[model samples]
Target: MAIIIAGWIDLDVEDVTDIIASAKAHIDGAYTENGCIHYIWTKDVFVPGRIHVYEEWSETADLQYHFDNHWYKDMGGHLRQFPRKGSQIRKFRVDLIEPVYDPSGTPRADFFTAK
Candidate 1:
């Protein structure tokens, strides 16, 4: 099963641009790793200091490999350079994935669960 990781990082800086710039290399490097389906860091438009992160891996082993990578090791130091209010990252094991939109541009009700 694939693993999906997602969360937001609240930065202390006035803007997330510089932080993104500094982390660009690390983010780009992730794409070359095995089982990296997607890895992204995006700034929240409504909140200036917030950064949203999303990642997908083929399996738990792949995610573990990411944790053991040098870039992941260096990320902590790089992030600490800029003060941050806080951050959260969570992982979910996906048993199934379905498209939300059908070919005809209609919503697929079966793809989502009701609250």
Candidate 2:
């Protein structure tokens, strides 16, 4: 099963843009790292100053390296500015995922025959 990580963050007005920018930059820079299948950052549409992070890693070592090097080691000061109000991080294995069709490709009901 793949690893899934979700985190919620609330930021002060001053740090809102900075927090989002940093997260975007980090993901863009790190997505090709050994175990990173997905690293998406999202802002809460309805809630002001709220951010959500989603990560999928190949293994525990890959995730540990990311936290230790990217967030904890390199971004300590930058991350400290964000408020921890009611924030939480959760981790789990993915049991299943629905497949998505590639619309740009030829339209075939069967994925294998699409090409």
Candidate 3:
């Protein structure tokens, strides 16, 4: 089973591009590390001031290393200087994570709506 680290950030309703860029950079660095399968960031289009981050790792220890790494520790400080309202973090094991198929036996055309 893989591990998933999910999180959300509420920016200060100001300029969010910078904070988001920083987060992407951090995730990019983490993705280059061992055991990292995926790292991505997204915004809630319906919610004006929302940011979501998802990380997938091959093992629990690798995910733990990410939390203990310098990027994780420094992100809070950097976001604080920006217009961040709050943040949340959660980690869980992925018992199953696979592609959803269409009725015709092809992969789902819409990634977001696949599940």
Clashing residue pairs for model 3: 12-83
Best by lDDT: 1
Report the number of the highest-TM-score candidate. 1
Q: Write the per-residue lDDT of candidate 2 for residues 35-71, one digit (tens) a residue.
A: 9898877778777777787889988888888876754
Which is better, 1 or 2, measured by lDDT?
1
Q: Give the C-alpha miss distance for residue 115 in model 3, angstroms.
A: 19
Residue 22, candidate 3: Cα error in Å is: 3.4
Clashing residue pairs found in predicted model 2: none
Summarize candidate 1's per-residue lDDT along 3-101 as a digit string, tens digits: 999999998877898788889889888888899999888989888799898999999998999999977777767888878898898999998787788
Off by over 4 Å in 2: 100-115
Model 1 TM-score? 0.89
User: Which stretches of candidate 3 lie above 4 Å from their native place?
Assistant: 102-115
Please, what is the whole-model Cα lDDT of each candidate in the order they appear? 0.87, 0.70, 0.76
Can you give the lDDT of residue 38 in candidate 3? 84
Give candidate 3's whole-model lDDT. 0.76
